[model samples]
Target: MIPLIEARGLVRIYEIRKGPFSRPQPVRAVDDLSLSVMPGETVGIVGESGSGKSTLGRMLLGIDRAQAGEVIFDGRQMPPLHSQQWRALRAKMQLVYQDPLAALDRRLTISAQIGEPLDIHGIGSKEERKERVRELMGAVGLRPDQAGRYPHELSGGQRQRAVIARALAARPSLLICDEPVSALDVSIQAQVVNMLRDLQEQNGIAMVFISHDLKVVRNIADRVAVMYLGKIVEEGSSDTIFQFPRHPYTKALVSSVPVPGKRLQGRVILQGEPPNPAARPSGCAFHPRCPLATDICRTRTPELRRIETGRTAACHLLANDLAVAA
Candidate 1:
């Protein structure tokens, strides 16, 4: 089956301006990354801060253009930003931001914000759009009375629901949710996550869930991608990744998640901070933090290759067609 959205070898760089009279430093926010999401599939992208997860999300939606490579949505190349074609395409792909208050207009009521997308896409008549807005508010579990309330008047969870309601207002084919529930409480996070999952399954919407929370990703994703320093270190089925991580970075990330009622015995605690993008490491970016780094890991970059069916990882220690770790 053809993917709903595909990013091929995307590269995005930002030039950071330093002190007075200092030259700008180049930071490759996303480097040579590629991904695709099939209809009704959820691909979770998990990584540390500055790993380019958010950058890749914007690039996939064409909000951030790549210096190299292309993005194809529904078999058509993404158009230039703000173009007519891009505007029309926006109705099919939507983004759910991490912060709800920031995403919503303070002056407008929740119902107005939810109904705005229908107006933008010209989806229906005035009465039909109003009905659709009411249905969406109900779908996201928002109360009828809360419709007229401003963003600041609602709780964090309620505000997030409003944001989600607005995103769904467009009936997008693909939803890119970037840390959508990170700001909410644990219980609220579960509610929102389950709501998103149910909504996706019911609508058959493809999703790209980007988060730093591994547990949440494990719950929502069919496939998982472990990224570090703008590169995908591991990609595979979510179960294989959580149970039998092969890459050292993937292992460390999975180990960081505390298992319920279990004491930490074989946890892989990594040392040192991730290298700055302006001055990335010589060979493998994770070598500075990898516990098993060797001469080869420090001298050459490992390509992300298949170690087995439905699994791929980049690590110098792993042999071809064989895993270094179970």
Candidate 2:
């Protein structure tokens, strides 16, 4: 079956200048990243800050232009940003931001914000839109009485639910949730996560969930993609990647997640900080901090290759494992 969304060879760059005399250096925020999400499937992208996870999400949605690569929704290439075709396509894709207050309008009431998409797309009549807003409120676990309140009037969790309701008002096929639950309290985060799962199961919505929380991703994602310096270093089923990570970077990340009843005695703690994107290392971007790095890893870039039936990793050491397994 064709993927609901596919990103191919995506590259996003940003230019930054430190001083008046210095030249603007180009930083590759996303580099040659490829990923896909099937209908009703959740693909979790996990990485530290500045790893380009959020940039990749924006590029996937066409909110940010890529210097190279294409995003295909369903089967066709995505339309150019802000084009008439793209405007029409927007109705089928939505973004849920990390901060609900920032995403919601301070002046608009919750009901108005929830029904705004319908008004913009001209989806239903006034009465129908009003009823739909109420239904959406209930779907996201919001009370109908809170509909008339402004964003400031609602709690953080309630505001987030309002934002989600608005995103779903148009019935989007794809939802890119960037740190959707990171800002909420732990208890609220679980509620929202469960709600997201329920919504996806009911509507068969495809999702790209980007977060730094490995445990959260492991809970909600069918597949997990571990990113480093804008490239996907490892990709596989959540269970495989989390339980038996092949890449050193992935292993380090998984080891960091605290396991109950287990001590942190032999965790694979990485040594150095992530290299600056503006000046990435020559071969494997992760070699500088990887404990298993060899001379070959310092001189040659490893392509992402299948290591198991449904798992892939971009590491020189994994190549030997593949040969042994073969």
Q: Write the per-residue lDDT of candidate 2 for residues 132-164, one digit (tens) a residue.
A: 999999999998889889999999999989999
Candidate 2 weakest ten by summed lDDT:
317-326
Q: Mind sharing the TM-score for model 1?
A: 0.97
Q: Which lDDT value does model 2 have at 204?
A: 90
Runs with alpha carbons beyond 4 Å of true place in candidate 1 = 260-266, 320-322
> Over the stretch 242-274, how does candidate 1's per-residue lDDT look in tens digits?
888889898888888887887877767777886
> Model 1 misses residue 215 by how many Å?
0.2
lDDT of all the models against the reference? 0.91, 0.91
Candidate 1 lDDT score relative to the true structure: 0.91
